[model samples]
Target chain A: MTNFVQLILNLLIFPGGLFAVALGLFLMGIDRKIAARLQRRVGPPVYQPFIDLVKLTRKEMVVPGTAHLQAFWLAPLLGFAGMMAAVTLIPIAGVYQGFKYSGDLLVLLYLLALPAIALMIGGSASSSPFGAVGFSREMVMMMSYELPLLVVLVTIALKVGLATGGIATFSLSEIVQFQLENGALLFDYTMLPALLAFLVFIPGNMGVVPFDIPEAETEIVEGPILEYSGTGLALFKLMTSLKMIVVLGLAIALFFPTPLGKNFLVNLLWFFLKCLVLMVIAITIVRTSTGRVRMDQAFKFYLRYPTVLALISLVLTLLQR
Target chain B: MKKLLQKIAKKSPWLYRINAGSCNGCDVELATTACIPRYDVERLGCKYCGSPKHADIVLITGPLTARVKEKVLRLYDEIPDPKVTVAIGVCPISGGVFRDSYAISGPIDNFIPVDVNVPGCPPRPQAIIDGIVEAIKIWETRL
Candidate 1:
């Protein structure tokens, strides 16, 4: 009887890997549709992302005569692997696929860095002037955003530490469990600054609007992926979709309350509802706002504003204790 | 039967704009017309098609300058037919600022029988939206 129960638990966890890919793709589709609707135009169907990937995968690889074909090939694969590793680390629906460590938050952050770094290296190796300029901008963008993001993570962890009697839990699963037991962070007055940090982090993490300087379509011709085509392009696109889902999951885990469900499907539904609301808000702001600041302006804003907010939240976390 | 379905599917007229030589004033208004709490073009079932072949209406802006003329014509020809062309902005309609320049090829209508002409130095978003709506009505009438 115990063996049968263990087998059932294994079945439940294995499907989550596949589910992460599907959920990621779906969130991306909705982001496009919502962004389009916000612009007052009908956007592509949600399935349009899938169609694009399929088409790109079938297309022949184009290698520019002057470009490093090897780096270009490896970049997308590294990006995809990094994101998959992050997803596997996240304990979604209380089911993790194999690797779940107490120090997984550190692993998750480093894994998240891989996609952008891969793009930077790949773009710089392209030997095109446009690619070089784009890679330079991407490097500056990474520097600016990651500082505020790290500060925000520390602030949240600080709050969780206070609530749980100074245990210093960095595991995402523990953080969510804390919220489930003591109500969501949004309900706590001490967490208001952290909430604001979350609001900034959402768009900044996705590299959309006000912060999308790296891929500003008008200024840069599609940015870091400008030289990419065929399967390479498809992998980059897939990483984008997966990245959105991962960020949304983090937001849901951090701020929103997860309701108790009688079954696995019901719990998944509840989790998705919290995630979808967070996603819609992020995408809507991107679509409605049309200000693309210079790289310096973007750098100044994130460092001064969100980074400061995260610091204040950390202080507040202490006082609330 | 698949071909017929594709043809029917093509008629509702999804458009994508490409600015070859025009001032960006037109692109600004075009973006605004499609944003929320405004005209809400999504309700119309028309979309901003990303590629030319997927689009039924190719909205061309700006005068035909020499450097961009080849690229523009190639993009225009790439659109699969049962398609309509709309000359947007006074520049594309009558070569506004660029007329009589050595680089220009004159009004867009000279090369393509424009299904619609939206006239303005750089037309207002509403005017552009209205022109596309009118084009759709004409398409429905033909159907």
Candidate 2:
């Protein structure tokens, strides 16, 4: 009973629900501020997203007459719930130990696809032509990015399993443990390509500039989400921010989760700093520096670059084993 | 609780542009308010959203031409309640150069409740920004 209670607490209070949401919003706010500063302009305050959320809750929700009401109402919750679960699976070194499961990584890989799937469902259910276009484009982007992500995960699983005298371990805690003892994989020459591939994958999965074709504001007017207003739009925004945390957390757990000292508070702060740095590099700078690419070009770019990069690491890890 | 929510919500009024049927001049100035750093509206916690559903401030450009009058009204109706309309340029306010043309049907307030008017042949980005600020004030009361 105590264990069950602890699980619930972990899911709702500490690392998963409220804390993750706050941290995610903070990271997003910082991303916007940095992007604005990069352009030599004063941006909205860091609390802007929080204000937006509050505002959305008070606004009236307008459902399209042609919308599939059930699906449209349910879509945002799917991604939000998935990310909430995904956050608990990621262990922060010396801070919060993640839920221990032998196959959590595999589970996470599936959970990570939920947001994209939700977007596609919502888009198609909206009955808008723009929504249909967004649905197709989102599917292509997901397919292209998933391949490289799969390859990268397999490579990491192999690297850890080989060193620990196992076939493969898809456990995140074990991965973090291995790195803590044997040094982070970030410094491993063979893991470099995989790290690069993951870096490339970040912007794509986050749907920032250069790959935000699905919700291209100028072209499709936010596509699937164009019709969603009030609380629905707020939920979608929260889901994206939560996703930012999940992806960045996963990368930290995978690569450089070396906690600072043994102090709990210090380690937590350290973990946040790492997330901020990663967000700036992988999302902010890249988004600020680039323009949207054509859907075909983005598909081809993901397939060619990150896919090959992750494949190189997979082959190297296999050869080393 | 409602009052506090209204206070917090007032800070994030998203703007949506509706091109009723002008010569694209006001639209160009509207773009500058977002694109040019010198006149950045984001600092006001204003974002230019693509859909009417997400908008809090309706920025109507161009004259209300007979061809697009119906579509414009439909678009305005699509914006959820508690929205303030800001007519940009003389066109939306009085049809400007297109006034009395056989195809023109503006002075937009005839159909939409325009709350603010930024009048210029093509209003300067600063004036448009000022109009947006005025609309946000009206929007706050409604919220």
Candidate 3:
């Protein structure tokens, strides 16, 4: 009874549902503001995303006539629910303990792919030609980025596990515990390459400017989401926001789970600060300065650089072990 | 509750453009106002959406030609309810230079309900922006 209630609480209140959504939307607003400023334009207020959400909820939702009704409706919900669950499993050094069990990281690995899968499903089910184009591009992108991501995860697991005298720890909590006991992986010279690889992977996973080919509005007419409007569109927006929190939170947990002090409030603030810095470095500046890469170029770039960087880190870790 | 939602929902008005078959003059002005820093509409919480379904304030450019009238009406129908249409150039409103051409199909307002008209052979950037502001006002009431 207690476990079920706790699980519900974990999914709904503290780290995942409301809190994650709020934080993610806020971050998105900040990103937009910063991007606009960088281009020397006055952007919308930071509460603009919130306003957009309210507007979306109030507007009418239109589904394409020829589309598969069930899949079209359920895709956004699937992504939203998956990200909510994934957030519950990510531990923040002093503030949260995460799901402290073996194979939680592996579970997160699979769960992290759900949004992309949901996008593909939604796009293909919409039955629009643009959606079909988007579906194929998204599938290729998933195949390309998942490699470096897998390598980075395995490299971190081995580096931590070997240092702590084990094979490889798939438990995220244990990885955080190990890092907290020692120093953060951010300061470790050997882990820097892996960190860089993960940083490169961030924009792709988040679907920001340079990596946003699948949903390129100018080219494919918003692609997968072209047919969605109102509440259904709002769900997709909400899903992306939660995804931002999950991805940024995951990066913080994997690379630098260090606490500033014993106070919960101070540490929580510090956690947000780190997330802000990570967002600025990995997402905002990169998105603002770069143009969108062609599908083939992006696929090659991810496969070549990040995958190799992560592989290098893995090889180093294995050699040291 | 409905009133409160409407009040807040007025901020974001996603814009979509349709070329009725005029030349590209008005389209350039629209793009410049939205994309260039000098006349950024994003400050007004306006975005240029790629799809009609995602649009709120529709910007219709060009004069309605005989060939594209059916397509334009179909696209307009796709933009689910409570949408405001802004006829961008003089072409859309009066057919501008192509007033009596066999290819031209009268004025745009003959078919669709135009909420705002920014008139010129191709309206100036300032005029286009003003039309957008008026469209926003009309759009707020609809929301």
Candidate 4:
């Protein structure tokens, strides 16, 4: 039992954690490449992410004088762990059998929220007024985005229920199985509004583009992350990258399900393609767009409008039935 | 023994950057230098050190404004011996655009003896990395 427990921990922490980190790094590199191509500049190599993390880890960690060091330090770790847990829940290359029971959509939602909460708490504890202000804006962004997220979830759930004739299942595998049987959500005419909701949610979820107010560098000086340096800063960035991957992965799984391949290599390739396509769309928009939105304007646009779109999607699903 | 030490230091000089009172243009470029893969400072054994005490090369950005003068001096003083200070960007090298401002002072070398002067409003990331590489060469030659 002890050895088995150790093995389980190793599996969860090593390959599981390692896979998320590597994928996160790759996705960030791809984001940079896409952003560069959009701007007509030669981009950095893909290994740029690995180089950055290595350099940061070796650097000294600087704790601000005014910060509550305890909270500040713990926040990034919490955010990182939460993101890793979410990644583990989602099937990467194989069948959803690995963490199947643990992979509930609701849990993924809560885990997805953890990174943002960590940012808020960490920023608020930094004791910088700017950091405080950033936290305030982040909270508003969170509040605004939360409604549309829920609506999308419910709409997807409703579609699953409809497909199964009221046999409700929130498991990710069941949803994929439903897709495999009846075809992808992208092919469903009724899913067009949900697709719109998904599109809007992508930017909001990654905190990229016109929606990236929390850590707006030009206006807020990396916002909540202003006081962080060294390893703490690196961890925060790593978590952000991981969160980006999780958001894109979830988006792919929901909107576009590529059937799992017979072997690991084929499945992995398909998985990566889906992820890359989503990441390219996300980062391209980020690079081409000019940012800096007032807190109120951002909330008003994302929450009110997208919620209506989600409602339309739900109604359409019912109408199709 | 000392010659061998100098050789090692020259080959792998770890850098630390301090932002006294930057407009942040230089800092972003500085970060970009470390980030963009072509000038990947990490492959050269050069990295951004966390603190001055552990740093071999100190790359100072922005003009030394009134508020940060003492802090800058203290940080410069804290670095261990055989350290080289490189004034990065135009602001730190000549006080750049803020030279005439009352709140601003002269170049960073005015506060601490700077070994190199890398001049650009926000020097390209590659240039900064190259400047550090040059500073390491100086350390190997003289010390």
Q: Taking the tens digit of each residue's C-alpha lDDT, what string does model 1 give over A1-321? A: 996665444333343335666777777777768777666566667765665554454334555568887887888888876776566555555433233457767777888788788788777766666668778888888888788778777877878877778746677777777887888888877667767777777776677877777777667655667667557777887777777767777776777746556566676777777777787776556546767778998889878987888888787777777
lDDT of 1 at A52: 57
Candidate 3 C-alpha lDDT tens digits along B1-143:
88888888888888899988969998988887544688788888888889898889999998899999999999999997669999998898888889899999859989999999999867888888898899989987888
Per-residue alpha-carbon lDDT of candidate 3 for residues A58-80, written as tens digits (9 for 90 to 100): 77888888999999989999988
- CAPRI grade of model 1: incorrect
RMSD of each: 6.2, 0.9, 1.1, 6.0
Identify the superior model by lDDT, candidate 2 or candidate 3: 2
- Chain B TM-score of candidate number 1: 0.83
User: For model 3, what is the alpha-carbon lDDT of residue B20?
Assistant: 88
Q: A1-321 in candidate 2: lDDT tens per residue? A: 999999999899999999999999988888888988999889899989999999998889998889998998889999889999999998999988897889999999999999999999889988899899999999999999999999999999999999999988899999999999999999999999999999999999999998999999999989888888899988899999999999999999999999999999999999999999999999999999999999999999999999999999999998987
A61-143: candidate 4 lDDT, tens digit per residue:
55667789899889899998898777766655353433556238889889989988999988988887768987998888988
**Leading candidate by DockQ:** 2
Among all windows of 10 consecutive residues in model 4 chain B, the one with the lowest summed lDDT is: B45-54
**What's the TM-score of chain B for every model shown?**
0.83, 0.95, 0.95, 0.90
- Write one digit per residue (lDDT tens) for candidate 1, span B1-143: 54443334433355668786888777777766532337655445465654453455678888877788788887776555446677788988778987898888857777766788899977877788788888776654432
Q: What lDDT score goes with residue B9 in model 2? A: 93
Residue ranges of candidate 4 with Cα displaced over 4 Å: A1-15, A93-95, B1-85, B88-107, B119-143
Would you list the clashing residue pairs of candidate 3? none
lDDT of each: 0.70, 0.91, 0.90, 0.74
Fraction of native Cα contacts kept in each candidate? 0.07, 0.93, 0.82, 0.00
